[model samples]
Target: MRVLAFLDGTLADPDAAHIRVDDLGLMRGDGVFETILVTDGRPRELGPHLDRLARSAKMLDLPEPDRAAWERAVRAVLDNWSGGAELALKLVLTRGIDGDPEQRPTGFALGMEIGAAVLRGRAEGVAAITLDRGIDPGLAERAPWLLLGAKSLSYGINMAAIREAVRRGADDVVFTASDGSVLEGPTSTVILLRGRTILTPPEHIGILPGTTQAGVFRGAEKAGFATKVEPLRVDDLLTGDGLFLASSVRKLTRVRSLDGTALPAATEAHAELSAAYEAEYA
Candidate 1:
């Protein structure tokens, strides 16, 4: 079952929650969203998620989201959703109808059951492929209007890349820059294991700052692994000891292979990644 709540205090019937057809968010993808992991009735890293939401809004020039209101709506959905199983809590904020200045922005919170594939892939690992993003991230810095670092709803390209990954016989993708520098996965952050250090690309290169990776890096430190945020390239993954992906809903999932070639299996490190992901608060 799904539990949904509107910022306007609407709850119970999801069908009743609706946005206008002319809403800029639906028409032009003028919106931002966050996918959160909810274990039982508790949300993981809610503060970080909200802060990112605000940052995305500021990037889009949308009004700052009312965080307290969003938190309450999240609670209401969790209360409505009854179960001990993990759930994906999606918070969506959109620009309201065009020319309707009086109308507040459209926003809602949705709590839904996690899919079997995402949950199973966590423990079993997944296959991935690398695709060039075809744009220099340095261009992203100069072209600030591209909104590169924000988690906006303009995800048509990202979804298309995933379809390409499936066609290539892989479960996910790791996007590289135009120069073949490692960036991140479509919906996850890329991590590489080298000796006792965990390395990832810095977020300043036009990629979204991963909230899950932040906590996981901390947990990895506690688990006796040093974590570093730096620049990486395709060669690094090809020669690394192991590779993994981390996301809020997916937590941490090891990459069993990339580009159809099997990677070196690091079962022990995979377990540590899982344990570290679990150590993140709910």
Candidate 2:
């Protein structure tokens, strides 16, 4: 069952929740959103998710999100949640009707089930194909209009890449930039394990800052694992001791293969990593 609530704190039926047709979020895909993982009725890294939501809004020139109102909306949904081990809590803020800046932005929180396919990926892992993202990574600094680093609602390309991956007989996608740097998975952050070090591309390379990945790095550090943020090349993805994709909803899923090539399974290290992930953080 899905539960939804508005910024004003009214709980509603998710299936029936509606927004005005002229809302720019619907008209032009103009808005920002954050998907948070709810485990055992608790939101993981909620502060980070909200922080990112605000950052995205700033990038899109939307009104600053009212944090307390969103928090109240989230609480209402969780209070109404049906018992479950996992949920996807999405908080959305839109450029409201007619795209008027003077109007209150449209906002809501939705709590829903995490799909079985997604859970299966976390357990059995995924097979992915590499796709060229078709942009110079460095260009993002010069092409601010592209909104490459913001988690805005303009995700047609990301979804299309995943569809292309499936057509190529893969379960997911890893996008490479014009410079041939392995950027990230369409919906998740890529992390590589080498010895005791866990590495990921820095956010400065024109990707959204990953909240769940930051959480994992903290966990890894406390468990004696080192962490670094560096650009990853496609070759590096193939040579890592272990490859993982992290997201709020998926938590951490191993990448069993890439472009039809099997990667090393750092079993013991991965187990320890999983253990650390389960320990979670405050």
Candidate 3:
């Protein structure tokens, strides 16, 4: 697949040697990022993604991103894309080369095709395993430096947890707090449906406030479905009428099984929510 990259103020080949070796984003993962799905060359929920990126940058003490610059870069990459297929536009901002007294932040945008695995998970649903995140749900408010709500580049642990789940024969992971409250997926937001009510863990639980989930909730409300933010536990998942993962790229994906136990088939609810989510970006 052809991939494009925008570095600083210029668009370049993604494989080009542009990033410095001392970049803190690569060295220490000291950065923040946002990914937006582009369909038919139009970016989905661009404003909210940029808003979240700015918030994450502030939380990380990184330099503020130039939204106009990023927008120009996104347009350049999308216009240059050869395929008519959907693309994943990722914006990355790193605290520039380490030890640089200026501490300028490195910003870039990359465009690539959405992964087949992500598409498959959306279509076929996913089997998930619950993993302890090793922290209390209230930790973010007390420990801001932990960057719980910030979408940082430091995803080693999250990726490792997913790998561990794969090793255990699961497609993905739903991270829970030390208290066993369902938090979120490693790369997605967790949502549960009971009858016509749509529920997700409250943002106070230290999970990233999901842009897509917010859109889904808005759509759900307009569609006459009750939407709420509530604490969820393992038992809640087991007993819920339906479970799903929501994100910008993955959209709304059903959870077929959790920890090897089959979940209720909420196909009708899933279809309704999926349509509602699609309308938000359409």
What tens digits encode model 3's per-residue C-alpha lDDT throughout 1-282? Answer: 555656434667777697899999999999999989888888988999999999999999887888888887777788788875688889889998999998988887888778889999989999999999999988989999999989999999899999999999998999999999989998999999999999999987799999989989988998889998999999999999999999988989999999999999798889988888778767
Candidate 3: residue 256 Cα off by (Å):
0.4
Among all windows of 10 consecutive residues in model 2, the one with the lowest summed lDDT is: 273-282
Lowest-sum lDDT 10-residue window in model 1: 8-17
RMSD in Å for all candidates:
1.4, 1.3, 1.2
Badly placed stretches (over 4 Å) of model 2 are 99-101
lDDT of 1 at 16: 66
What TM-scores do the predictions have?
A: 0.96, 0.97, 0.97
**Compared to the true structure, candidate 2 yields what TM-score?**
0.97
lDDT of 1 by residue, 48-158 (tens): 999999999999989999988998889889878885578999999998888885856989999888888898888788999999887786966898899998999999989
Runs in model 3 lying further than 4 Å from the true structure: 7-9
lDDT of 2 by residue, 59-116 (tens): 8988889999999999999988985878999999988888465777899999988999
CA lDDT, every prediction? Answer: 0.88, 0.89, 0.89
Choose 1 or 3, whichever is better by lDDT.
3
User: What is the C-alpha local distance difference test score of candidate 3?
Assistant: 0.89
